[model samples]
Target: MYRYDEFDETIVRERVKQFRGQVARRLSGELTEEQFKPLRLMNGLYLQLHAYMLRVAIPYGVLSSRQLRRLAHVARRYDKGYGHFTTRQNIQYNWPALVDVPDILDALADVEMHAIQTSGNCIRNVTSDQYAGAAADEVEDPRPWCEIIRQWSTFHPEFSYLPRKFKIAVTASPHDRAAVKVHDIGLILKKGEGGKTGFEVIVGGGLGRTPYIGHTIRDFLPKEHILSYLEAIMRVYNLNGRRDNLFKSRIKILVNTEGPENFRDQVEAEWEKIRDCDIDIPREEIERIKRYFAPPAFEALPGESASFEAARARDAGFDRWVRVNVVAHKVPGYAIANVSLKEPGRPPGDATAEQMEAVADLGERFSFDEIRVTHEQNLCLPHVRKDDLYAVYQALKEAGLAAANVGLASDIIACPGLDYCDLANARSIPIAQALAERFAASGEEEDLGELKINISGCINACGHHHIGHIGILGVDKKGEEFYQITLGGSGAEDASLGEIAGRGLSSSEVVDAVERLARFYKRERREGERFLDAYRRLGHDAFKGAIYADA
Candidate 1:
């Protein structure tokens, strides 16, 4: 994990001091709601439907155990005993008092964490692969580069106020766990000419009212030139992206209106002007950042752990959990354990203060005192020993964090819809809860295999419903809550927006509708086909026919 330096410490302390005064002004009526909107947003505070929500950034999803413990403290002391981990690899405190926000920020600053850039029209938190350093398939850890971008973008005067919020993501794995294709800027690290590291850059990818899988603007951009290239892209978007309509302001809309080729050309022309300037990070600084993410020391152990195998043989529950929640590590005898936050009957990403503390302790004991937040709304112990898998599972089980439903039908991604957000048209958490319960009750989650069901309160797509294998978007229908389903969506390497299946289903019908889709897939899928593959082969009509056959 990246540690804060003297400069980092100074800036955070100064920001906290400055925001303390700003917040005091707002509470004292010296600043009206309109006057304080941008100021509060810049500090990651939002006036939600019922209360103020504070979003704190967990950069590139990495956290030290100490940091996690601090977050747990904040939840226990300030909010309502829980925090919501978000799809952007951030966490939200939903019930912080207006006057107490500065105190909360000060608490966060103590642990080298803050809410800066977590919200606002400026560049948001830079996210990356949860399994970055530990993944067996990775070209290299992407977190260093993510850190580089974070350093470059934070408080950047040029991109301080874009037409819309900008998001960037990076991945070093070919498996695409970061969902790079759906970001405003996506970078895939790859071995370029002479086996040197470089990036394949994608631009204008986003999901909101309009969704798009980004265009590959640069087939290969040297790692050394990443900052300059990103600057070029930002310059292009800032100059030409629409400012007239709120709905049409995103870079994706600009890319669509001007076409990818023209957008790429514009970026290239801009890059030609500044690529050689002093904007790119120095080689020494890059190497310095890289040192922070160096892999933790590992004992030379056999690839397979006999104790782990014995535990799996002894316990069916342990075996099932290992099958679903554990992934292979790049290091022998180690594993990346995903902690599923989507327990049946719970809000998808809500982690109780105790659960957070439990996970922090588990990470401290097993994973080099580090925890990772996945873009899919899960926490990860990115470097646990395979031999310790059972112990970790037992601890998680005790904390109610071990659901063993990763990539299963029960592992849902849902936003805090009308439950929190004033922008939401309908509630999303209940739908997610109902679906998870339905799947768990049926005991078909394991059988379904690698199903992603994402629910969004509204079309802002905060839940990333556009990329789920089965997407449920809440819509208001004559004072009734309805869900519009979409099929064949994926956020993987084969990223694509889902097609709307058919008419909206009422709250009661939506869960059954999802069940129908799953059962239909089970019946209709060809041998060896997953839900997504089957959907692609069968198309939207088949799923639509099954769901709406009785509508």
Candidate 2:
């Protein structure tokens, strides 16, 4: 919700102007594909299998109704009639023409949005909890800090081209909904001594060919020095991170090779050098950023809504939806409603233009003119009145946006695998669709409580499969698609990379394999254990046996 200041506006407009010229040159044959590769990447454009893809940044996953409408417009006019919301909380247009990209950038600039830093080797979109300011458990809102980092890192010449792409995420809540531990840099906000808020910085956490749960480099860094401290971390990585092998270029590889103790020492030494510099953030600017994220004017009302309670009593389907999709808000008489994009039998994260428009209208009418894109590939209305729940449900239900699977098995996270990406070894969307249908048909989706199934087309880990409770990675065996399963992975506060269970399953066999494993988990779990917990206690061998026992 941070409106662009005049300075921000100028920066975006200038960026658009620069990209427009670059795009014109490429179209006119003045620039070859090789020459334009980095230029296009710098602007978040990619050459996929079938056509060019444009990824637009939704900063910290916050969107105004106006921005949402702009995205809908882009889908309607520029590409196919839909866009894919990615695991990074950004949206992708899979079939945009190269000539139309500048126009898209200009349109985004008009709405105070941009594709800058959504791709390339520089820091990617700085993400945070979708429930940031609204969640009851938050220590403080993290978006202002994210905005500060965005201001500092965007077009920062020093970090323009690193050895590999960088990503940062912040989570104010202890729950770690932002998958902070799996990012290149993860900031966990907490109240330190003397009631001062600070960050517990985690570095070297990322998932790709090599996976890591970032090590804690600093236990407590005061909020005032966040930028300076981040500068130190980047300086250390830039100075010594690998450049010889593309596969070994990420900060996680560097940290693992150097060892966490040595890496920590390097970061601390760099911090000491720059901590007292003029990089200290201004109090007034910090206050200004904070003001944009202050809670919406919520009316004072009683804790319960009579109509909502009555409706729940009357409609079992709606009651089930409320149980799964609705989350508690900090304010009384308000709730956070998560709109599921992972409807059964559809590809995960694909939102049609019409559905996007429907969400935009619902946000404007019922949720204070704002919508949030969840890292789980869903949309959230962060400030819905409890009294309007049924009407909101009806609106969403009619628009094909009302699936009540939030943390359930049906809410899958999948990348556009071989279907879109050139780097993919296999297809991911069909696997997700198959599993969704399998679960729905068996009536097993609702029975499996709080499961996360993440699928990646390749080891690039764009699907974040490494952190799912059940992780599925597509691998190619002599040009055939096969899925390798991993269990016990989680992206929460207790973040861990999933362990590979056993041999790969054919695409035809993967869905039934997943159901078999789920039934196994249900039978083996202790009374209070979730999938990850059950896996930890029961061990991988037991689950592996479950998958192959009946095969």
Candidate 3:
């Protein structure tokens, strides 16, 4: 993880002090609610449906054991006993007193964390593949670049108040685990012709009311020019992106209106002037940032651990957890273990204070004292030893953090919908819960096979429903909650936005509709076909007919 330097510390401390004064002025009745809105939002505070929600940034989704422990402390001390991990790999506390926000920020600052840029129209937290350094297929760790972008984008005068929020995601591997295609700006790190590293830059991708896969603006951006190129894109959007209409304010709208070719041309014209300016990335700085993410010390061990095998054979639950939760690591003896937050009926991506502390302890004891928050809204111990897998699994299970449902149908990705979010028109968590329980009860999860069901309370697509194998979007119709389903979207190398099936379903009918769609896929799929593959083969009509047949 990137440690905060004196400059970083000073900036955050000053920002907290400023926000404290702002809060005081508001409380003193000097500032009205309208006057205080932007100030609170800039500090990552939101006045939600019931209470103030504080979104704390876990930069690039990396956390030290100590940092995780502090988060647990904050959750227990202020607001509720749990915090929800979001799709962007940040965590949100849904209930917090307005007066206690500064204290919360201070507590976060104590661990070198903050809520800065977690919200607002400026660049939000720069996310990346959760398994960045640990993934076996990675060409390079993407966190350092994410960190660089984070610093550059934080409080950037030019982009501080954009037309809308901006997002950036980077991935070193060919696989798009970070959902780069759905970001405002997506960078894929790859090797150049002479074995030099560079980025494949894509811009204008977003999901909201108008979902779009990013277009490739630069096929190969040199490593030294990343910041400069990003500046060009931001400048283009800042100057011409829609400002009159909130719904069309995103860069995606601008890109759509102007066409990608013209947008790319404008960016290139801007880049020609500022390409070698102050934003040019220095090699030494890159190396310095990279040093923080170097692999931890490891001892060479046998490919398979005998004791681990013994525990797996003896414990059926442990075996299931190991099979689903653990992933391949770059190092042979190490594995990336996903600590699932999606357990049966609980809110998806939520971890209790105790569970968070337990995970922190487990990371320190069995892994490398480091943790990651995946884009799928799960926590990860990215450098666990394969030899200690069973021990870790047992510890996680005891903490109510062991769910063997990674990438499974029941492991749904959901946003804090009407339950918390003010922008939401209908509830997403309840629908997610109902569907998860339905699938678990029907024994359809195992048969569904690697299905992703993502739900967003609204069109903002915070839950990334646009890219799920089965996407559900909640809308309000005449003050009633309704859900519309989409099928066949993916966020990988062959990324595609899902197509809506047909008429929306009422909240009562949603779970049944999803069940019917799943059964249709299962029955129609050829041997060894995943839901997505089958959807691609048969198209949305097959599933649409099954869902709307009796309507």
Candidate 4:
């Protein structure tokens, strides 16, 4: 984790002081709601239906045990005793008092975390794969580049007021766990002829009202020129991106209007002028950042652990958990363990203050003081020793964080729909809860391997509904809330948007509809085929007929 320096501390303190004054003015009636809207939004405060919600950025989803404890403290003291982790790799506090938000931001700054750039038209959080430095398949760690981009995009005057918000994600693995294809800018770390690192710079991918898989603009850009190349892309979008309609203001729209070739040509022309300018990142700075992410002291041990296997053999619960929640680590004796937040009947990403504190404790004791938040709304202990698997499972089970559903149907991804969001039409949490319970009771989730079911209350796609294996979108028709189902969507290396199945189902019909699709896939699937693979092979009609049988 990158600790804040003197400069970082000073700037965050100054930003908090300025916002404190702005908030005081709003509360004292010196400024109206409309007047204070932009100012509050700039600081990651939103006026939702019931109360103000504060979103705090967790950069690239990496957290030290110390930072995680501070977040737990914030959750306990300031607002409700819980926080909701969002899809963008940030956490949201739903009921913070408007007057208490400044103090919350101050509390966050004390831990070198903040709400800055978590919300706004400028570049949002620079996300990467959770298993960045630890993944076996990584060509290079992508966090240094993400951090570099973070430092560059923070308060850059040129992009401070873009037509729409922009997002950038970096992934070093061939697996594309970061969903780079669906970001405004996506960078894949790759090695060239001399094993020198560079980026496959992708541009224009996004999901909202209109969805797109970002196009690769530069096949290979030198590592040193990342900042300059990004500046060129931002400059091009800022100059020509639409300002008239808020709906079409994103860079994706601009890239679509002008074909990828023309977009690439324009960016290349801009890059030629600035590629070797003073803005280019120096090699020393890159090296300096890289040092912060170097591997921790990993002891050499055998790949097969006798104690670990013996413990799993004794306990059925632990054995099932190990099968679903544990993954192979780059290091021989260590394993990557996922702490599932999707316990049946709870909101998918909600972690109580006590649970957060427990997780921090687990990370410190068993995982080399490091924790990561997964894009699937789970917490990961990235470097847990294989020998301590049973003890870690026991700790998690006691804390109510030990569900064994990682990629199963029960491990659902859902947004705060009508329950918390004013923009929502139907309720997503209930639909997700209903489906998870339905699957759990039938014991069918384990059989339906690697199914991703994502739900969004509205078309804004905050839940990433566009990329789920089974995507559920909440729609309002004749003032009634209905759920639409889509199949064949995936957010992997072969990224593809889901297609709508048929007519939207009523709220009461949602769970039954999802179960029908599951049954259809199970009947049609070949050996070891995932729901996505089978959906692609069988096509949408096979599942669509199951759900729309009455229609």
Candidate models: Cα lDDT each: 0.93, 0.92, 0.89, 0.91
Candidate 3 per-residue lDDT over residues 1-551, each given as its tens digit: 78888999998998888999999999999999999999999988988888888999998899999999999999999968999999998999989999899899999889898999888899999999999889999988888899999889989999999999999999999888998988899999999899988999999898988999999988898887899999999999999999999999999999989999999999999999999788976889889888998888987877788888898899988887888778988887888999999988999999999999999999899778898998899999998888888888888889988878899888999998998888998899999999888887776576677899999999888888889988999998999888999888888777999999888899988888888888888888899999999889987788789887666
List per-candidate RMSD values in Å.
Answer: 0.9, 0.9, 1.3, 1.0
What order do candidates take by lDDT, descending? 1, 2, 4, 3
* lDDT tens readout by residue for model 2, 1-551: 79998999999999999999998899899999999999999989999999999999999999999899999999999988999998888999999999889899999999999999888889999999999888999999999999999899999888988989999999999888999988999999999999999999999999999999999989999999999999998988888999999999999998889998999999999889999997868899899999998888899978899999999999988898899999999999999999999999898999999999999999999999989999999999999999998999999999998888999998999999999999999999999998988887777677778999999999998888899889999999998999999988998898889989889999988888899999999998888788888888888899989888788
> Which candidate wins on lDDT?
1
Query: TM-score for each prediction?
Result: 0.99, 0.99, 0.98, 0.99
Number of backbone-clashing residue pairs for each candidate, in the order shown? 0, 0, 0, 1
Candidate 4 error regions (>4 Å): none
TM-score of 1: 0.99
| Candidate 3 lDDT for residue 239 | 93
Candidate closer to the true structure by lDDT (higher is better), 1 or 2:
1
Candidate 2 minimal-lDDT segment of 10 residues = 439-448
> What lDDT tens digits, residue by residue, belong to model 1 across residues 1-551?
89989988888889899999999898899999999999999989999989999999999999999999999999999999999999999999999998999999999999989999888888999999999999999998899999999989989999989998999999999999999999999999999889988999999899898999999999999899999999999999998889999999999999989999999999999999999899998999999999998889888989998999999999999999999999999999999999999999999999999999999999999999999999999999999999999999999999999999998999899999998899898899999999999998998788889999999989998888899999999999888888999988999999999999878989999998899899999999887899999999988888889897665
